[model samples]
Target chain A: MAERAQRKIPDSSRRSERSRRAIHEAALALIGEVGYAKTTIEGIAARAGVGKQTIYRWWPSKAAVLLEAFLDLTGEAAGAGEVGGEGESESEAYAIPDTGDLEADLKLVLRATVDQMNDPRFDVPSRALAAEGIVNLELGTEFVRKLLEPQLQLYVRRLTAAQATEAGGVRRGVDPRIALELLVGPVTHRWMLRTAPLTHEYTDAVVEYALYGLAPRP
Target chain B: MAERAQRKIPDSSRRSERSRRAIHEAALALIGEVGYAKTTIEGIAARAGVGKQTIYRWWPSKAAVLLEAFLDLTGEAAGAGEVGGEGESESEAYAIPDTGDLEADLKLVLRATVDQMNDPRFDVPSRALAAEGIVNLELGTEFVRKLLEPQLQLYVRRLTAAQATEAGGVRRGVDPRIALELLVGPVTHRWMLRTAPLTHEYTDAVVEYALYGLAPRP
Candidate 1:
């Protein structure tokens, strides 16, 4: 088996890249199937058809492996949003678009989030990880810090830009961090709890309710 | 064991009540320790020191048992809010207070919710069930319909009244159902994710941002 693997990839750089991708795929699939608690380095390496040392060489821990795997998954979605040629930076593509209409921009982004959350490939694995996170405080904090918070930070950036925009900006005093949570928190609550249909209409209502005061407009 | 239980309660009614309470407590404890999937009818009965038939006689399934158990736990918190001299209805106790000042009323209730969520007895068992619910759609849906939605409906009732009230009410077009999610959702998200400290100050800020438009007040 080792000889076959080595023969199939004569170039070490290409061989390493192949092993990394396989490990990520194996990690995601295993975590989704058996759950985070049961998924292990040996299992992942066996599934990926690589030595356990290969996984260890790339990641210090299982959590780190899963973290990078999720990042890679989200990165694919981000990369797809790029209109620029292949050479464009990854970060710019993942940004919440500044369409100059803050409300519209937010609604658009949230709608896409609804779509992503609904997709089984994303939703199933995410639910598994999120479920584990809920019970395991250390894992939960790491999931938030590594995966969820970075995505949230995008909203923070967009909202902050809206604050400085010439027109249709948020009020000066509103904390972008907390304000961003208003958009994210509600959608997440519904999604996680399975309380309501996560439709575009629902997300739009959230955006509208959030932007305009719930109280009567004076 | 049965004879001793009967001797402890000469009245069958009192005996049944004791058994029911034990079953509920056992279900909660088991679910907290072993989680929803691993928790079973036979296990609950063994832990509660009751016959399997006794649990099934009271609850149709393990899910039903756990649901009632959680309701019982939260019901204690709800019951404590009552001030009447013993004749008050249970539903009345759970209602969000309508003090004519919408902001104050919301903040008060949300603060109470924060307190409930932080309690280890409530928090630990709740997190376990919630974690299970995240991955288990059937349980998640059942949990929402039976427990969460009813609690949320209190917000709906309050918001609907606010719309009709002469002072400090919501706007005419705001859908109370959707509007209530903004309040419940963010707090739930913070509690479940442990993204930040779920404090009175945070909830108050949520209430303020939610009531006032995130956009600059025109």
Candidate 2:
């Protein structure tokens, strides 16, 4: 959250924690149903069963509420059982597994992403933010920088490791940042545009195509 | 247009043509300025100096006006001087140049696509439609089927030709439909998310990586 809770007695602190979770749940549900344009702070508060002031005191605006809600959803979705150290957000704890098999690791993570995209809990609210972000530059850039880029960076980190050490690794001439997109962009494009069904089979093909060239090998 | 004008004498036909052009211009400008949600038929008519009745006479909704306007813009941007046959829209005339040199041909098309994404004439209105499509299934699916899928098929056609004959052509194992996404997706993901500056240099690299494979050549 942008603002921290004030010093409080134990009883009140527990109440505040409950309110925060409720507000996050409410924000997610509301955005899923009505989209960002139609979603309002008052509406979120009403659905959350908290006072309007309660929302404002914790968040600066509706966008903030949705963003925090999204972050929370992403955290729960990243339930790999590893916990972040105190003061580390769950996002920090999330990392692409470096299993030494680049192809295997990528396929595993990408299949999980496909599953997340299919999950309405993440998909609906994510679409709300992505739609709004397309038209609203500030919000779009914020989410990309704060949320999306980090996830993409995990791919970069993995590919970079491969380039440095693996046999038949990613080409050294390639930029890991751009190369990561080859894997990510196809899955995301399919999901965002609804051009085709996003499936484990499709993602496995993407991984196969990206790692090995399309052209016949010499 | 969804509705054809009533049978017109030459003088009236000329005037109708002028009104159609004006409405197209108005729709493009208004959607860019106000976005899809705020843009309205009354606003478009007011800007075009046509009666609301005149607009309603031909198009069913603002979405229709914008779709045609977009088609016209795409046609103009595709000003390769090859006009479609009678009764064929310019979209039909559009094709990935088959120079039989797959790499050069793809680079040429991707470069043009990058130019199109940067052109505010197409970019602004396209984003408006895309943003709306994320949340509105009917419109999203309609635009994809009518506008985007046809264009993507052009790439599929080019790739299929490559697979058939090029010496180092696409491997027979690769699916042309999925393969096209690897080429198209990265450029698009970067453009839509604003993660990085989309340049000819970036697209060149994408083509290189997608064709050659990120994995080192054996």
Candidate 3:
């Protein structure tokens, strides 16, 4: 097993990683410039200075390439906050903090989300992909399942942890899944529709409205 | 004033109305097939069997044409439910029925929404426009202002009414605007993402989850 693992890590592995990063950047840039339907595998390969087979060997389709590229982008962004000496883990890259203070924790994460949404680096490509997702169900579901749901589940975990705590943390009967939507949905609506500007203020409002009922608390 | 109003209704005006309806239908059809960016005023006029000047005389842009076309379609749908009784104003056509039962009213409207979301006639064209809106901010804001917000406001009105009532109803402190998002956002999320099959059952669940605090009720 050790020998097989060593063999998998070829001397060319570092070159492969560089090629992969180029391919991902090219995919995102192309999708952002031209819409998704017009973005072809050959186009991405040409932009990346890579042979088409290199991308094909890694991803089956353009959608797969874009999805993985986005995933990689999000992972890198999340990794920036890593407290050194803990060694990076997948959980550190994706996990929502469960600080026992559900409200404060949720507020912190949502504020970060507001900042991300405002950043053109994230927004432009995401909007392009989302535009495609609006019309393409197969692609939409794949992206949602792989990218969106995992992030949403982190909220679920945080909410569930809140539910488990003694004293009135979260209401017991609350389905964490649906409850999380109350937090996420409004922000998404604002972002997708461009009905309003997304800001820390707006996200803070959403967090407040979701946790404490919009109706006057008795 | 009445004589002037009558004189304004020329024979050409009547003919223009017919041409306008035809143009709207053509725009919707063409957009549904080729999508918004590819959909053109000339194409719409050609499909409608009208002169390009006829379309130009009526609307400034293709976006304006599509927006009016959608508004007309919604108006027609709402009209079908009207019994054509005396004093049934235009506002009545757009208003969500307040049957004094907020939950039931919301469910009925949302169930109808589920049907509309599933219907190919509405879904196909809507997806095309929505896809364009995702990337186009000015067009998107126009859509939200003219179309989406009016519909959302109906919920705001209903929630406000519920809050005003003395009986067990929405809490007064609840901002009707934000309160409405709780109900609308999740359904939109499901429909837009195709995360799951949208059904009356799912909408019912959203309403239930929203109204009865997810946390255990005292």
Candidate 4:
């Protein structure tokens, strides 16, 4: 989380924004270099060239700092429209670009997601956080509620729209929430598990298979 | 894994089998209680009431011990046909009941998988190991190859069979390996990420959606 954004400080405080960005970058770099367990607030402060008290005043705990840093990184990514992470602007961040072609729109978004997950800056720290979340239930639930679920909701909105559209809309009785998973889940499994290479071809295959059933198409 | 199993020692040696089972139980119990990082070989030995050398002799590292222990637990579950884990008897363990219906067979197997994941004995330790694997790339890769991939292969073989069969076969051009992810990945995402309540209702929906495209029926 950008401190200024969260605190509702005026944009005039460029120095504070610089500090927040440095801290975010430091937290991410440190976590990526050393696993989540080893990351420390003091260490982050040192790395960011800020006093320890500065960090303490801003964030409550190391987890909070890391969580916010992650959110900020994703928010920046969303701001640039580089990948999957949505920004504070819900409408723009979550919009799925319904090009009147559901398949094409989904492919576009998912392909970008594949790129985002593969990006080193995002992948390394995200994996560390994700690893921690798996064992740490409280942290995991918070991560899901705050980060992952909101992103998934974007898909829900897009799918819901597709349901209403006449041009290749979803079939009756299909749940948008669950249908979105068929597309998202496979990519996530491959990326997280490292079971296979996550490539455009793979994402394309996933989108195709998800839109059309695996059994022979009648 | 199990040195005794590999050595083909006579089944008459009940003492050795007992010791191995004890160690496996201890490792799983310790990891589930304390998390993976705190779990040690000495701890496992003390808990099992066996000498430390016994564990070291059988497995090279804590990871190996936990891996094999998990394997044993799941194998036992598979032997009972309680869940998805395949037993030593590949044919029986891997077999998806070929009742001439592919969809039913997939659903039956996936539902069993949900049950296995939900089982406390499996869920707790498995989560710890999975958590460690996420950050530790080497460990994660090993876990996937030793534990996850083999189980996935069972799906691959079953799907291949479905492909060949004239009745309820998968459509041409669907890669069994990738197609299997559609079924397995969503459930894993839910189970691992704790996105929502994993239930038969959810698994059933997944199966229905995966087998039938989301697109409207003509």
Best by TM-score: 2
Q: Pick out the ten consecutive residues of candidate 1 chain A with the lowest summed lDDT.
A: A82-91
Docking class of 2: medium
B-chain TM-score of model 1: 0.89
Ranking by DockQ: 2, 1, 4, 3
Candidate 1, which CAPRI tier?
Answer: medium
Write candidate 4's Cα lDDT for B80-194 as tens digits. Answer: 6533454445433545567778888888888888899999989999888887787778989999998889888888988888888666568878998998888998999998899
After superposition, which runs of candidate 4 have C-alpha atoms over 4 Å from their true positions?
A1-12, A82-92, B1-12, B82-92
Identify the superior model by DockQ, candidate 1 or candidate 4: 1
Question: Model 3: what TM-score?
Answer: 0.85
lDDT of each: 0.87, 0.87, 0.81, 0.85
For model 3, the chain A TM-score is 0.88
> How far off is model 2, as Cα RMSD?
5.8
lDDT for residue B92 in candidate 2, whole number 0-100: 78
Q: Is the docking of candidate 4 incorrect, acceptable, medium or high quality?
A: medium
Query: What tens-digit string does per-residue lDDT give for candidate 2 at A1-218?
Result: 43456644468878898999999999999988988888999999999999999999989988788888888888787766346678986567887787788999999999999999999988998988898888789999988988888888888888999999857378787899999999999998998899999999999999999999788887
C-alpha TM-score for every candidate: 0.89, 0.91, 0.85, 0.89
lDDT of 2 by residue, B26-70 (tens): 998887788788899999999999999999999999888888887
Can you give the DockQ of every candidate in the order shown?
0.72, 0.76, 0.44, 0.68
Clash-forming residue pairs, model 1 = none
Candidate 1 residue-wise lDDT, A1-218, digit = tens = 88777776378898889988999999989988988899999999999999999889889999999998998888877655534546765444478887899999898888988998998878888888999999998999998987788788888898899988658569888888888878998899989998888999999999999988798878
